[model samples]
Target chain A: MAFSAFASAPAAAEPAVRRRSWVALVLLLPGILYLLLFFITPLVSLVFTSFQQPVIGGDIGQYSAGFKWENYTESVTQYLPLILRAFGYAVLATVLALVISYPLAYFIGVKVRSFPLVQSLLLTLVIAPFFISFLLRTLAWKQIMSDEGPIVVALKALSVFPNDGHITGTPFAVVFGLTYNFIPFMTLPLYATLERLDVRYIEAGNDLYASPFTTFRKITVPLSLPGIVSGTLLTFIPAAGDYINASGDFLGSAQTSMVGNAIESNFLVTQNYPVAAALSIVLMAVILVIVGLYVRRAGTEDLV
Target chain B: MAAGTFAEKGADLELVGITKTFPGFTAIQSLDLFIPAGSFFALLGPSGCGKTTTLRLVAGLEEPTAGRIVIGGQDVTATKSFQRPVNTVFQSYALFPHMTVLENVAFGLRRRSIASPLEKAHEALRLVELDHLAARRPGQLSGGQQQRVALARAVVNRPALLLLDEPLGALDLKLRRQMQLELKDIQSEVGLTFLHVTHDQEEAMTMADTIAVMNKGEIEQMGAPEELYELPRTAFVANFLGQSNLFTGEVSGSTPDALTVAIAGQRLIIPTARAPRRKGTVTVGVRPEKLLLLTSAPAPSSGSNALGPGRVIDVSFSGVSTQYTVAIPGAGDVVVFAQNMVFGPVVHVGAEVWVSWNVEHGFGLEDSVEEAAAGVQDAAAAQSADADTRTGVTSSVRA
Candidate 1:
């Protein structure tokens, strides 16, 4: 009863404080309205459109008249395999990028801290490829993999593969391109996190009679987990939604079409707004679930 | 040439002329030291005086440019840190953030080619009185608790030597005092030789059985803490170890057991039974606490000496004691400290006082005077050369 009375006392005094807080609310009204109008309204409209069909006059008011469940069901049934394939490619690309970039990042961050010029040069190299347009970069890869290109001729000379004229229209090529495009994203975050790590931990490990490999495994790896989690998420999410290289000259095959390609086709060619909205919702949901589990396992503070 | 044999029992570690040099500068130069078996030795110095470097050399984190390191009578100069039987508690504690207290303490044991890891780790934690924090991560523990965990981790290995690099520097004053006594007690209980590095004079005096005072890559003096304080051999040692009043003088005459030095137109005889030789020019050193203040002159005594007749320039009333800066005829100023005997009249600022000490309380530094004068000349020449080289490098870097 005393606790209840104490709580009530605070509640009775809150109205005057709340009236003052209204002044702050008034000051924040513009930003709040801007977010509600531009960000939340679009998301709500998209959600509504994902379940509603267009009327005869092609007006959005038809969404209030009726709802269509077939949009969602049809997307799951017809495009499930494509969505799964996109996720698979994203996972493969993220893993490959991590494997290739972690050691490089460690070397640059820790081993080269005394040489600022070398570190800056390496960072510039990582970011240099991003300066070119995405379409141009993918097109350049296509040209390099063509029959008359040096890669094909060299492979033929080495007898690595049958003079299989061009390897362009393949899922392997699409994944390779995606991995190459997203490697910088993985490496930069890993470098940032690894750079902030205290090198004294390694020395302490050595003092504890741990060999170099044991120290790296026990101290370096576990301490860099936050970086690894963040780098993987940063790379995988964007790679999964990427369709520029898959639909461009790099790999113009049905087998290589990701959910992004499917959404683009629905919006631009077929004009099926409902199905496109459904596909977008599904992709967002899948990404949310995967990222949610990853953050939970690693802890939210690490993810941020 | 005077290499000593290792003790048959207990932890034995020795460094023979260990030297560490950076690109163009030497951090430690030809330092020969030995930690007697089961002794708590302190490497004490001011900041950047190479005490920490000496500890690192012993711990195998750093390789000496020219020397040998032997631990437990085994030559460990060429061995890696992990292969040596020495462990270090770094200044920052360096506890693994990812591991719990139990896991951190168990790290070394788990890596060892041993059978029962958990039992050993548990026993070690219990020894440090940290068994209750077994499951807590290092980040969750307080600074003192983290220090305990670090100690537990190092001791669990049962290494021949424990090297501590200012392990308690991060703690607050009260906690540090508590840890200092605890560390000494733990060393005695464990019966392990500890090579601890610190710049705090009080910490070294409180914890060490033997303290080596270092300066500019060299050991200035090494002895028991009280011996070094009472009879510092050089002006550097006297100033670095504690606050001392120094007076430069020329030796006027000498006997077998005493030397009369003339300072500021006053003749003061120093009882120097331990003097290396009959002196020429000397620096007389006396601790502030040793000087006595007399309002009236005493009868002539054989062992009595006086260094001043000037007025008191300033007086500071510290809680437990009072300090007076007395001015002399030729000497600039001399400080004297007296413990508060009773709550009587406080010494006024401008009171005339006689500063005196017994001959036994004064130490003569005639040999150090010659060495210091030569060192100053050489240092001046070296400074010019260094200035030229630095300017050249700056120009090149700019280009």
Candidate 2:
């Protein structure tokens, strides 16, 4: 009787289970289509483009392209320094942003939990600059660091440099602007991770005889490392590709011109389609390598 | 180096008039207690009875509003929890998720101003029989193993006192029973002054040498488990500690050893061994198991002070016993638990029965109903006065 009852119950419930599976498929179809159309297709095209060379006066006018290993070789050898420099700047900016934002995030997330008003005020201060146009914010930095600006006058008064002192159009200024622009990106994610952290872990550490500093280092830091890695990636990737911030604030000085400037010059001002495409593909490859290494080191779980 | 050495080193802990008041509620009210050198003492109560607050006060996780706490004869009332010579196993275990079992156990020893970490941690793990699973993280271990890791972590410090707050409340019934025995055995082996707080009466009775029954931020009674169960001083203590059938009556006469009370128009004599200030209306408390069920009323048994004819209202067959609810004339229902001797015949509902107990089996309580009623009124007035004082202090502090 029990066997018959079980068999009948499953038979009766099969249609409901099938209906639920159908509903799941219907809900998932949109996201699946979006990934295929936008992400997968673009990634395949970029890889294919990286290995191809543009042919002038081809039969198809613009469609015919042949595989060329020389493009990859020339780009690596000739433009490797610029690529490395861009990565260097991205790393420096990410590190600086992380160093400055960690304590701020920790303070806002953990220390100021009892003071909602203060916490909200701090969060607003961190997020307020984003509300303004990014170009205008970067332009404002250019004005502030000009030779006639207050910063130069202050520097002159301090006898820290020549009386005609100015930090405008310098690599230092570019890095400073990138760090300032991306600090909130680093801080907000870190704040979220730290805020959701179970305080019991820290209390457990204390109970187990860990000093406050030791507990923070061993427990809080390692536990929040996922946020750190994600925040770094979020900040660094954009900062490396930030042409507007770098060129607008630093005035496209040669030393400060990153891969972002190279891409802008090739695509817009220079209007060299093939070279621009090549540079875009190369830049994408470099970013992919950096991100892949980072993801591998930090574990993909950190991204989610 | 040895168990109970901390007690020999000094008295483990003392709390003098500890009080904690929150925004509009008083959690603990002027509690004075002392945990001896190496006893498994339990602060047992229902929810909202301030047992956890008492534990927190001893752990230095809470600052008593008006009291002093001393551990190992050293004043630690103002000290931070980290600075105190004590460790706590929180209710959830609170095992550090990022740490392995060995690291969790080693944490306290590593923080010690004295003692080598490896040696102390090893000793602690060995004590809890968790040395083999030391490499695994708390998440990797079973619930029972995680609990032992927490125990090892706390004991590694050899703190003056160990505070366990409902450490086994999260475990399943079988695991909880096993842990009860394990904890009692561990306490005996370590001989640490354990101050455990729990709401489970059975858990406290089974594990504690001394049990303090707390109610509404005050301890109703504190004594050895057997004494507290066998001779509870008040209805609250008797009911809170275990199930008891209480009969309310006015004391008509008293002797050195017993008292005669009129309960539901029936005259009954009750022993007064643990009675407190017994001159007025009294409540006679008798455990369910103490009442014997007879097929026929025995010829007025000697030393038996109470006899009542009752009808068995309900019979429930527990695994080891049959519990019968009996109703006496003019009196409310009383539960009578009888051990199942053999399957002779079941006591069916509506069966006529005689329920009686020896005078020595029951004790009388000075009526606390009036006092409990008055206590509510006093608490309200006190709350209002406290609010006023707090407002005054707030304005003053603000100014």
Candidate 3:
């Protein structure tokens, strides 16, 4: 609760400029009241639950409120592999999405700028896939890569797939699903930035005796850094916390379960609320630290 | 060695039979031009008159559909833009937003095997007097400073030819005047061939040694500023460069040196030696400053001023001159600008005056009156239409 409040405090400074105004306070009452009820109250209770102790000689789900910080340590020790695997899959998917989206965005933004008809048509095609349900799309991908699907059958006939090898319930399928689903998230921000790029800079580069490749490297790449940063962040954050694609009933099996699956099973099936809440808090903290380091190391602070 | 050859014979930039066609329009048509080495030349015209197209052709930014380009006695028509021995200062400045001022100036040098790139970049910045701001990005500088940086970047390469495409168009009026003088000074100090393209008549006249006035993808007239202004051969040239009072006339009599034209039943004499193509039907043009207004009748023996009575229809007093539009009995409205000396004779709107000018002051032109009027109307319509389309003016975005 304190962390979230610190993150959003800067954005609330405008209305607070009039420090003595009851009208400003009144205007913010509804939103503040809503956050207190739905967000802050539940968040405080979750933190309380994270410190609860399991009751001795009681039912399996019974517990008592106490100082049990050991719950956080035990959860981290047991689920450390799943936590690291989740981040690895997220990093791979985010990188793949960025590599695939940058060229597609550039082609739609700069190459077809003169032809408004073709440009809008291609942009619409990029976004049209979102009209279908996300679960349906992932399910369709599952069918396409299943053991009985044409891709697996064709590989088996060509002797590329061994008799015992399979693509279903593998890490490859999970990462592929994550990348395919989050491509639009990566593309939209990139398109918005590249669409406004000035072509005159490129011509100026050529006029200065720089070759076409050098011009793209020095001018185009640096100008588009903001798009690349935003797109990667957008794809990576949600992919790190996603559970459906890595669940046992979906693309992954028991061996490939991620941190999200572990938290889900602990919370719903086992009814161990303290351990689940501890894992959730740890996941949020770890993501925040990784993102902060990535942003600092990217060294695009001046460009943005 | 290449610089030695260029210095010996000048830049010697040449364009032979150049033509450029878009989807349905031909921007340039068989244009032929030769820019002498180490000369400050300008291509001056109104909007869409192919002046910019000609500059881009020379810069190798656009390949001409038909002609060949030769620079320093070498054929460069087939070469790419980066391979040409030339550089351009873009109208937008187009400074690399991510690079500092020093890096922007050193961009061209770093691409090739140049020695002491950092020293050379600082020297170029010193020429533009912006060396102290070398560590700052282009966005941190003012518009005038950015313009100077662009100039420094282009000149640092020291190519055979330097092309400036409206390099001062984005500055304020006062800054533009200052940069115009600075650009001219830079060109002379460097002694490289400078080809400037602009639509501003005053800028072109003040900076260029030779000016080519282009119209509709063709050169209408090319000469020194005084020559083009004094002895314009066509109605378009006379009206475009400066204001001219033109009257349609017919050649009633002729001499070996002059011709007497009958204009509105009044006889006017124009020198035949000075006129280029004088058909029987000709248009007589006179500069507004050349016509002298005399409220009183001239002496009977005076032969220098050919006199006619007219009524003043309009009067405007500027700081240095008083311009009057007089409606004459035979000729249409004749505009006369008199120097504001001693503030004598405050002419009212309805005052009667005698409009007189020397016979040599009038020149015959080739365009008919109908053609001139239609051309002016078309130009006015085009200007307003252009303004409507460019209504959304935006400030430059910088990081």
Candidate 4:
């Protein structure tokens, strides 16, 4: 029954091809409708809200329709330091994620390749954090960094921390949560690239008088650049705009409040629609610019 | 040159009592080989026959279970691949996909920090006629072009020994033949010792100065290509190197002229020098091209061996020659190849025919010692043995 529609009249071959395109267009209707209703509508509404002006003498949350572009300039000026701080935390988190993930990905992809079941078990462990709510995981980190927790107490015991100092509500805790939550995103892409790396290329390099370290530098590093580029984008884009880790309800204190926290407060606490909309738009634009510059610099066209 | 230094020219390679064993089985058993400087050598065998393992041992990719490898009088068995002065043209051409062809060729030079690596790399590229494509990546090139890039990459080093592991296995037949001549030319022009490993017999014969026929983790025979083909010492060589028709018979007697072998109530004389075994049961073989077909028996001649009155079972026409399979009742089907100087096959199927050959062309092998050399002959032997069993004479029964 499924193939019968495809097996239309042969004498009308041209018409059948035309009809086939119509059938393909019909199959696309639901996705197109969903994108238009959910995505395009919200995006246009957000852009409209970013340009809205506050009513000179109205109640809270009231605004007038106008091209009051000052909303962008004013909000960006007020939150410029927090915006830069968000970017700094995101960059640090992405670098930490990469440093931790590469070895784990390489271990799964190249080292345990002959033991596929063990490799798959390790891969499942990397992904197993997703099975629980990240919010709950963030709370768990909160507990782990509490005063009586082993990590804080051990650091105090080791003299790495001043005995009188504390651990919770620090920038380290917020960045740690971000890195922990986004590590699997960094790892899976790197694994996909490394698993398909032909060992023969490495052997050829070795045979051509390349020391193993030189071969890793010349061949392995360049080949995995595509993975690093994509993994960085995946981690950075989310980490920069992530409110969960930087919210006062989570890891952040007043000192570590990132742009995401400020935007959240502007919308819910202050009931300021234009500033919230403006902040979200600015976050997306800056991420796009950073990603564009990164992809161009990395010089790999095979991005996924 | 001493232990790690290389001579300016190709170096003689010596493998003394090389043995390699895996966990499950022995790959190569107690093998010794010597290749003179600058000779193109081939290790020819079927898959699982340890030819590739032998190549890996020499390349220092796989350590031998027990052996010593000496290249240019320097013991390289203990050295890593990068420390040894050896380069390889790998099977899939193993070119770096991320680098331009020029950069791929320059990789080894850069590793050693050689002066003017790119200049030298371009010169090597020009040698393989790939200089025009040097700026492009290997992925953009065709299989043939990538093959040339690999050749250039290996040849640029000018190592004392160059290892090629089935380098032409990926090309089509015409391109493989073209590359065979090109590879031979490069070897001679560079004057470097080449040790090529392959499963293709014709490829080995076409390119190598010396061919080592390996079977079952052992060297069956090693000699010049034509010498191995013409005077193969083992039945495995006779069957594996090319087509051979084998017959088992008792050594009846000898004349000053030749030794006589009696088969099915007929006596066939082979030269004394041609027969390896002078007494008891022996297996004699003649190449297919040396045999001719006749519709009727001629008056018996003293200088010939003829097995006859067989019926033609099949005939196939190749462009250069016509091949016929003649089935003798108590003897196996004998293959005959005749040149196409005339039209079609000289005889048709189901015709009575006599298969004849010059007596000097036949060679005898020891049947008792070569019981393991019965693989390719088993199919034809089983058929004839069945027929002999029906008649209760059993002329060729070794099992």
Candidate 5:
């Protein structure tokens, strides 16, 4: 009986696999439809709208579809500084978050591994910030760093800033908010990678006569490259396109506007659909290029 | 003492009163050991018996609770692992995955500030026959190849002592056997004190010049392989190293060269040298190969021959030897191994036969608690017995 079952198992495997593939296709239908409806359609419309020509003396912001590619050039000419500042702030925040999170992740992952309670407690603390609304958290920072806040008052009294100067509505405040809010994004990926690192490799390094620092530089850092790349990607991508942290009504002033704020104002306040779509397309393209080059230089495969 | 030149002479290692205790359990009790210069020493035991712990202590990876470790006549008990003149081939092979083979082998030399490390690293790789794969990373090599790389990486430094912690355990059985011979060849060519730790009894018996069998964190017996297998001191050693058929009986008489004991109305003579020191009631043991199964009882040629009647209960043929299980009247089931040197009549189950062996083959140990107390005092006295007398019995049994 067992021999017949074993001999017939291979004959039955083909139909089972064919049915499983069909089941997989059925399982993937909803996700594929959702992407097609929400992502691909809007992406196509955005590209189409980017090449539209504005009506001459039409209503406030009416435009018609045509080969008027000047909309792309005009959006770039008007919002180039904002675009550059957005990417600059994102780069700075990603770097700052990585610098702050790598050691914290290493401590939580490796140092406290023997203490299960303390390790989980620290990991929960790293993720605890996500319990609150991100916009509300940015608003809270706004109130804390306002001119009437204790920090600004103390800085004024210490002559760190002039009496009339204020920290609100500044690039520094915008960068600080981005760095503070995205730190968890950078930390989780790093922690996940470092948690699986084998301590025996480090011991082997020490046994081979490498000093502690030399071991970290030669062994730990290289082995943790995948974590560093993924962490920076998670922090940098969302930060480049975030509008609430850099809006004129929030941390930013008119002078500190970024591409996200420009796109928001153009679409809602000014109602310039073509220019807004053009600016959004430009931001996405520039980020894709930068991330591709970064990942290539880091020598990792596709995104995490 | 010149740089980059390995000394032909090996270093002597000594451990004095070493003890290692964890938070609640002691891994090793107070222990003392000595490995002479250039000798291949092995620590063999089952799992969790502190063989690895003892090797780690010698490598300076674990600090002993109370002891001094001396190497090459220098007190290195306080030295850190990196500063100690030793290297270990880790059980996991722990090769740097990111570095090329040459770089991994040259890592130790670079730390020592040796000049032209690549040249020396290539030389080491050639010794392991891995020089052609020098540019490849560790992940690209096979398991056996990676093992050789680990060996090369450690041996390049020419540390005073080379510690192998189950080095060949990860390979397939055939490869393990081949590597054992190669490892023996490497140790002889390098002339360094190699301290190997393994749980495989055959591996220890084949490679080590001196074998220490540990049990529950202490050495049960330490001697040459033949001496340990032929003449074990305790029941634990006798059972652990090989199979032993034991019979507990009272001593009826003693002479200059034989001991007469009565068991279930039958008299047996045991060699005096192999007899227990305190001979009231003792456990007599003989290896399975020493007991012979015959169709009938033989004539008593001398007082040093033992013969007993039994019925064969089981018979098994294992290529070169035939095994028979015999049930004597009071000896329980006794196992015997008969050599298949010629086309002999095969014994079947339930057949009556006689079991026999020379008197010199039986060894006795004190079985009762009262005699065992006196046995402790006679431990040193037993050691005083001449080694030549032991060789005489072991060599005759080998023939």
Candidate 6:
């Protein structure tokens, strides 16, 4: 039956198209098996765990496999503030990353293109942070904003910061860390699209009575939509669940704890396996929903 | 936005002492030109002749190093491109890939705060016979379709002047021919000043009301197509515009009606009216089609010049005409294009023949033999790989 269904397609297509072939199936088999083993299998177990219940009078970290629909509601009620804060921080970081990366990408990809050496050097600077570990970078930022740090001490002397005020444990620090870590993700994709942009389209926009700013709004932004969409996805999805920047050991403190930190503490220290799994599932679902709405609203399928 | 006095109707364009110098070389020398409103003018030349630069200066995309640009009796030298009454159909047909055909065409009207942009866009699309494809994206259209869409997008604004920068260079030969004629029809219908830049000689001849032959950042000659082709005053114009059988020599004698020049002791007559004004040495030539070849010496014909007894070195038979390369005793090879009329005997290679043409068909140039020889070399180099090289340079300029 499958063969019959597939037979009509290849027969109609010209040979040049090569629409169906066993070589393709063979090529895809490794990827499919790899995803099933490494990614999908763990995901299935996580879903099952999200629906499990704790054992009555049992040891810590032990659970009974059963339907527990109340687990979702219980986790949402207990850590509601953390979940909301996680999403809010992610949105702020994504917007900041977009604004900062666009100009940098434009400068490197289009403006300095005539000087190849300068372009390469600027691109290297953007990617240089990746050589260091993510946790190390967050820790470094924490030290730079500490009370005794050079920047904070200078700000205090200038009366820019309060004498007794602290920079760590603030929402601003966590968001700043998120934006900094994800900026390369935004810049590289934006550069990929902007580098290949045909200048004539922009010139045509100017020729059609669009001012320079208007041309940027109508022509350059629309042409770079693909990059913007991918960059935002890269930033928002990971940032929403990030624990390092919000953990007490890094840029943030207990007041700034996100959904990730809550899940980590429950899973390891508190040994509340069901609540941790439920919280994890909630975060995933929330990200998926927001991303779906965003992609649909952007309408980049036609723009690119 | 100092476009307060902008004229919606077609407007004349004038360039006074315009010059543009790039990093290594001057693209346009100090020059002055005036183009009347509502006329279809063409700038024709080989690659890198600065025609595109001149078009950019007039479009206000490039500022002249030293000159004033006037349009419709207004000095617009400092006006920005967006405020100028000009639009360009780029060589690559640079349509916005994100927008649909109708949206792309309506873009300008919307920018200018004009009402009912969609209706006007549809009307322009119908003018180009592309209304049926209005909803399709530019990326989905074929080259010819995209070309028409680009044209429609520019014409929808009804700018006083429209610049076409080798707009059909990307199409196939047959499609380019079709678009040439279609563009001519659109030009007449719109009654706007259409400044077309092209490297294709046949296209300029087929579409342009007037053609300017440009060489090395300067206008060599400008006139009606037939006039320029028949009586080119410069060696560069004669060779660049079309194939010429140039013979360079010192003037042997002169009469009230004609001047005779000696090449390898063989004399050829050029009408005094067609001779270049400055007198010492002269280069005279005829178009290939104007030359006739006879297997034997003709009985002395009136009002004609004859060069004799040459051996046919090569014969290439095209459908409508056959080209023969004849090697004269003292002169270099001269090319003659003979019509392939039915019942005419075929002339094979190695045949002895006499090459001849009417005296009125001969035109003289003051440029010497060295200049004509240099022109022949430049023309040979330009004919091959000219199209891709030019388009590549244009696309890379922004970088």
Highest-scoring model, TM-score: 6
Between the candidate structures 1 and 6, which one is better when assessed by lDDT? 6
TM-scores of the candidates are 0.85, 0.82, 0.88, 0.89, 0.84, 0.93
Q: Write the per-residue lDDT of candidate 3 for residues B1-399, one digit (tens) a residue.
A: 232122332388998999999889999989888999999998987789898989888888898999899998899999988888788999999999889999999998887657778899999999989999999999999999999999999988887799999999878789999889988898888888999998777889899999888888988778888888888766667766777887777788887888877876667788887665466777777899998888887654323445467889998988799999999877888889989875754688999888778877888776676766654554455455545544633222211
Task: Select the stronger candidate by lDDT from 4 and 6.
Answer: 6
Clashes of each: 0, 0, 1, 0, 0, 0
Q: What is the Å distance of residue A165 in model 2 from its true position?
A: 2.9
Q: After superposition on all CA atoms, what RMSD does each candidate show versus the true structure?
A: 8.1, 8.4, 6.4, 7.0, 7.5, 4.8
Order candidates by DockQ, high to low. 6, 3, 4, 5, 1, 2
Query: What ranges in model 3 sit over 4 Å off?
Result: A1-30, A34-43, A115-117, A299-301, B1-10, B296-307, B344-346, B368-371, B374-399
**Per-residue lDDT of B269-312 in model 5, one digit per residue for the tens?**
77777765547777777899998778888777663445467888
Instruction: Please list the C-alpha lDDT of all candidates, in the order they appear.
Output: 0.82, 0.78, 0.85, 0.87, 0.84, 0.88
lDDT of 1 by residue, A1-304 (tens): 3355557677778787757676788999999999999989999888887987767776543334347888899998899988998899999999999999999999999999889999999989988988998788888888887677788889989898796555777888888888888999999999999988899999999988788999999899889888898899999999998888678546547778999899988877787778888999999999999999988887736321
Single out the weakest 10-residue window by summed lDDT for candidate 1 chain B.
B1-10
The order by descending TM-score is 6, 4, 3, 1, 5, 2
CA lDDT of B17 in candidate 6?
A: 94
How well docked is model 5, in DockQ terms?
A: 0.35
CAPRI tier for the interface of model 1: acceptable
| Top DockQ model | 6
lDDT of 4 by residue, B1-399 (tens): 233233488999999999999989999999899999999999987777899999889988899999899999989999998888889999899999889999999988887777788999999999989999999989899999999899999999888999999989878789999999999999999899999998778999999999998877888889999988888777877877887887877889997768898886788888988777888888888999999898889569987889988999999999899999999866688999999989888889999999889987988875453562465554235335444654653332221
**For all the predictions, what are the DockQ values?**
0.32, 0.24, 0.37, 0.36, 0.35, 0.42
Stretches of candidate 5 off by over 4 Å are: A1-24, A114-118, A147-172, A252-256, A301-304, B1-9, B75-77, B250-281, B298-307, B364-399
Q: Quote model 5's TM-score.
A: 0.84
Candidate 5 yields a Cα-based lDDT of 0.84
